[model samples]
Target: MKTKVQAGGVSQSPVIDIQDLSLVFKTADGPVNALHEISLTVQRGDFVSFIGPSGCGKTTLLRVIADLEQPTGGRIQVNGMSPHEARLARAYGYVFQAAALYPWRTIERNVALPLEIAGIGRDEQRRRVDQFLELVELQDFKKKFPWQLSGGMQQRASIARALCVRPELLLMDEPFGALDEIVRDHLNEQLLKLWLKTNKTIVFVTHSIPEAVFLSKRIVVMSPRPGRVIDIIDTNFPTQRTLDIRETPEFIEIAHRVREGLRSGHD
Candidate 1:
């Protein structure tokens, strides 16, 4: 899915491409615009974060990318195909804001649910479940149910389940938003490492400036209702960066720009 824009040669498509995208919801009272003229492109292996105030349509935009919500206007393509086609091709895995795990099933079984539905053999399912669980560092907890795990641990399990399908893209919607700061920081570190190892394109949704700065290669600052793209800020930090990088002036500078973009959009 990497962009192969060769010099004087044919160019490959970006991982995601959106052009003048818009969406409106039909409500009891009237039509409510959720997104307006949203245009952005994501390259393979890049990490992008969407951040905005509450009700700003960050999640709505993400859902559009996932094909969970259909757009009322404009166009979007995921991995050179329509979101519907890409989804059928298993081009991406989505981790929702909540863990959304079933307490009835053990961690391994939960992770295997998709594989099961795909009609994968038990042997291959076990292999993928084991592999992804180990990647998320949840191998030891494979036998535990969702209720038995801490919120962070359960979220990790949810991540493992998402990764088991070996998707080219990962869509995470505030996956750690509800966690304690200490735990969230730890997960951010781990997630960066995971991205480095897998080289998968990730589109994450978050409301935290620090979290977005820490994890994203590019941060898309969004406006209020009828969400518009206010600014797209790039973080040039190395992939191997630690949490300590947040203290650097470079990090703070970028965060300031993102904040200013938000404020200007409101104005």
Candidate 2:
């Protein structure tokens, strides 16, 4: 099946494309298949979510697209370039489940680490660091160490770090899974604003049905072990999504559909 790209309620060229993707791991016992013929496309500036049960290869597939893991077969292109090239060019930013911040570095310096590695000038790095911290609403905490903040605040700082370079694509893996409900909701809303402001393509992985439904322009539902694409649902909602939208009938309808898809996969 061909993957489709939906952006602004219409189809468009994919910013990230995967074709006949497959992955296998060789262990002491034998080879184990993790993913099978997984294919999908994410259009530029679109928020796409990957949802599935645990051990469904959701994270594995993400690693492949991020060039952190190699696929046993198939092809992947990010902005028309191979994943490796994209990684080398720093075209993508990744947010893992944990904040993974350095205990010693202040929040501002943490955000500036990427720029330092890229050899960016100190003045320009400071400018971008401040801009992103404000973007994530962590500007006031820039001088604090990671251990000084709460879990949610640390995650925000990590996000600011990721966005400091203004990457073309953002890849996130259950970024809010560890936070409380209230913090999670607040962060979700803030992320949507950042997405709109930056106009950057985003591919997010999550197991929360409501979270996926609320944030995604499209949701890619995957099946169990040896994961493969099972369904791709377009949200068709307006760009200015809000918490109120999640309570609307249209939003509920789409969420119901996603639930049905997940049930079908489990059965």
Candidate 3:
């Protein structure tokens, strides 16, 4: 069931609404504060990137939004609904650093996994699977197993699987972090195309400055050691950005700004 919380009344009803989010883990030694009082608002159809150094709470924040982890303090609402409720409704699709595709499942079956869990009809699932494969330019690899594909191809399959269910929110945590620079560049371009085509709200976490700049409409820079939002930079780049756009002065300027944000967080 969809969330009952109304939008626009409280803080404009962000696709992701995080307020004073704090996380702590009690261990044998003492309490470990993983996230500080971090707050963010991600609007519908917005592509946002979270960039921070190691030990920062980028992934933890994403997990909280995905309902995989609970915050010790603060609240998160996805589409005006609680994260856990939204997760139960399958309101978002998640792609992790690794593709995480099952070894035994073929590409099509893997793509159809969510639909199967949602109890969608076979014919509808088949159609959606085929459609998303085509969207990711992997329609021909429908029967291929995960092992049969290269890292890039496997990530593509993972993306296809994530989109097969037509989720409104896409949570990607360093999906291309494992690929080489050249392959990562290629996938970045493809991801931009897919983002435009689908118009889904994307929350991507990455360490690469250029990658984050290229893929996001806005970059959310977080501080290390009790992570918090240090800065948010908007990239007013054209929607039809290409490889040549990366070399343009505008792109360099944005990258510089992001680098500055990252540096400021450490000081």
| Predicted structure with the largest lDDT when compared to the true one | 1
lDDT of each: 0.92, 0.88, 0.90
Worst lDDT window (10 residues) for model 1?
A: 1-10
Rank list by lDDT: 1, 3, 2
Kindly give the number of clashing pairs for every candidate.
0, 0, 0
1 against 3, candidate with superior lDDT: 1
Q: Which ten residues in a row have the lowest lDDT in candidate 3?
A: 1-10
TM-score of each: 0.95, 0.93, 0.94
Structure candidate 1, residue pairs in collision: none
Model 3, position 125: C-alpha lDDT score: 97
lDDT of 3 by residue, 1-267 (tens): 122223336534689988899999788998878789988899877999999997788999999999998999998899789999999888899999999999999999999999999999999999999998998888999898999999999999999888887788999999999999999999999999988877788999999999999999999998787788889999888898887788999999989988898898898
Better of 2 and 3 by TM-score: 3
lDDT of 1 by residue, 1-267 (tens): 233323313234588999999999999989888899999999877899999997789999999999999999999999889999989888899999889999999999999998887788999999999999999999999999999999999999999999988898999999999999999999999999999888888999999999999999999999977789989998999878999999999999999998898888887
Superposing all C-alpha atoms, what RMSD in Å does each candidate have to the true structure? 2.4, 4.3, 3.4
Indicate the TM-score of model 1.
0.95
